[model samples]
Target: MIPMRMPWRQGDVLDLASIGSRVDSLTDLSTIDGGPGARLTAVRTQAQAFRREFIETGTPDSVTTCDLVTLPYPTRFGLFRASRAIAPFLAITNRLLVIRWHESDGTPRVLLFEPSDVELGRYTPYFDKLAGRTPDVVSKRMVTEHATVLTHLARLRIDPSEVDYLMFDHLHTQDLRRWIGTTAPQPDLGEQPTPVFPRAKVIVQRDELAAMADLHPLQRPWYQPGTYRDVPPEAFLPIDGSVVLGPGVAVVKTPGHVFGNQSLVLNTATGVWVSSENVIAAECLTPEHSRMPGLARWAREWGQEVVLNANTIETTVDQYNSIVLEKTLADRSQRDSRFLQFFPSSELTASWTNPGTSPTFTHGAIAHH
Candidate 1:
């Protein structure tokens, strides 16, 4: 790693606005230049080149999911009419991805993706307003498995200080005050919060990080705007558009879920897998196979290739294109070739916690080789 001052202003270091500035609409770019299909092909070519280089020498040797927590998600949001699931609330499991890889120069790096403090997440008004009716006793039982990001990292024998990058698919329900440390002291703790990964820098999209400061009315209920105020500027590595963090790994810009929403792409021994909440299940990529009553029929009716978790959709078209980019970039699933290998960072699972819902297929982990 280059010797740089701690808390460096990495967010300011990259000129990331080109992705959002020139285009009047990302979808419009489609007609002029063979649309998103052409653009996606270019990206896939580049991503595969990166992967081939990694595999010939060495790809990522360490990559695993750290199951964090589960919550009650409204069925409507998870399926977005892709599934005619009648359940009011479905079980959504969120996890963190711990990735270790080497740059072409041989520097090792570690990134923690979506290492959320789920307990703190319960307060999100968007969720509370939707799943709030469930009793805590019932919600607590919703997830049969539980783990913390910090605890899971330790079990893997990784030290917090050794962690290099902290990332998220989006900042919708994240509170980084404890993870990155706060500049101000707070109640209860009596002192400023110390960071979990003191030397780590968060790699977030430039626009996404900026949006957290002054959230839109639509964004307010979901973002913890207050949690970021005390974070030091040097603690972030904000970039614009798609970025290949290292060999075999790229964080591609996937707008629509949020303007700055991006998905993680990793090339594994089995194949390339894109991970994000762009959709919540493996079948969402191939909705025709969805067992949910409405999902398959709705997808077939519309000639749609992907079904979104459309709880928030001011930019639905862009999300549709973005998810297609993911599906295009990923390899077909080994277990089920009919589906793409794109995995949901937060997968839906059947648990007594939310009795009425179940995913046609679940991919809880992405460990290959």
Candidate 2:
């Protein structure tokens, strides 16, 4: 077990009340169906019951749930490394890669890269807010705090030469700006002039580069209609096609969702497994505006479509892609259209007069009887 500090009062307990309060539609419950959701619910209820049973009956699991605390930093770092190691190959371009290393002799090292200036500003403030300190301080502290973990990796039982990179997914990177959106001095951050690994040339897909360029007010070439938005133009480079990075690893362009967003499909005799970071998340299963296909277009943003290889390896498989064109067209048709909405109280009542049940008021985050 790893010793770590809890950031919140509830420790490892997820705030169900907070999650429930955020639900605005039935679609919210769609993702909560059987399997993990059910399992999660059971765990929560069992924990509550155990508390009551132990407090009243003086009996409980030998190990209490609260007592089995999670190791925060190590877990986070592990996941971060995994995302970075897998992303470029997986075709994921949105996540940031932070590296920390320690020499076997005990010297500490920390490396940080923002890929670009916009990503840097977004993540810097996020690290600051989350750590309750300035971004640089938080970064330094993360290294100091996880020095032991770094030491362990450095002195690997297996040769260091055999190991390559570490990678993982980071969803919160995009959400970092939510707290400071359109409020204060949110200036446009410039490119990251100094890279974390100055000696190593960062491998950025052409698509990612194009997408980055399009984010600038002056570079609008990538966002033209018929061309996928959010993908960088370089993603279309011929070299991007099934290029071998290592003996076993290869980079394949699987764009969908955003123009440059990709997934890494690992090929081993066992099977081919794809790691698509942001193709979908738990929240996507919900029936929210975000899930609606055409919803983002009005804001000049476009949804990414995953590219699956077929017999030709250049086009989508016929059997699988039959519906792709139709769905894409439907989504395009709804572009710039308003979402479904309810009317004012009097109008709603008049429209619902024939209904048997009493009318319920619907507001963004509030529903009244």
Q: In terms of TM-score, how similar is model 2 to the real structure?
A: 0.28
Off by over 4 Å in 1: 1-11, 15-58, 128-132, 143-145, 352-356
Quote model 1's TM-score: 0.85
- What TM-scores do the predictions have? 0.85, 0.28
Question: How does candidate 1 score on lDDT?
Answer: 0.73
Q: lDDT per residue, candidate 2, 1-369, as tens digits?
A: 222221112222323231112112111112455754363343334333322322221211110000001111211121211121211111111222223333334443322222222323234333335446436653443222212222333443222222223222111233222111222233332321222222222232344434433243322211222112222222122122123232222233333333333333222222222233322211111113332232123222322222121111211222112112112211111212222121110111111212211112211110111
Off by over 4 Å in 2: 1-199, 216-239, 280-369
Error of 2 at 280 (Å): 5.5
Q: After superposition, how far is residue 110 of candidate 2 from its true place, in Å?
A: 19
Cα deviation at 324, candidate 1, in Å, is: 0.3
Index of the highest-TM-score prediction: 1
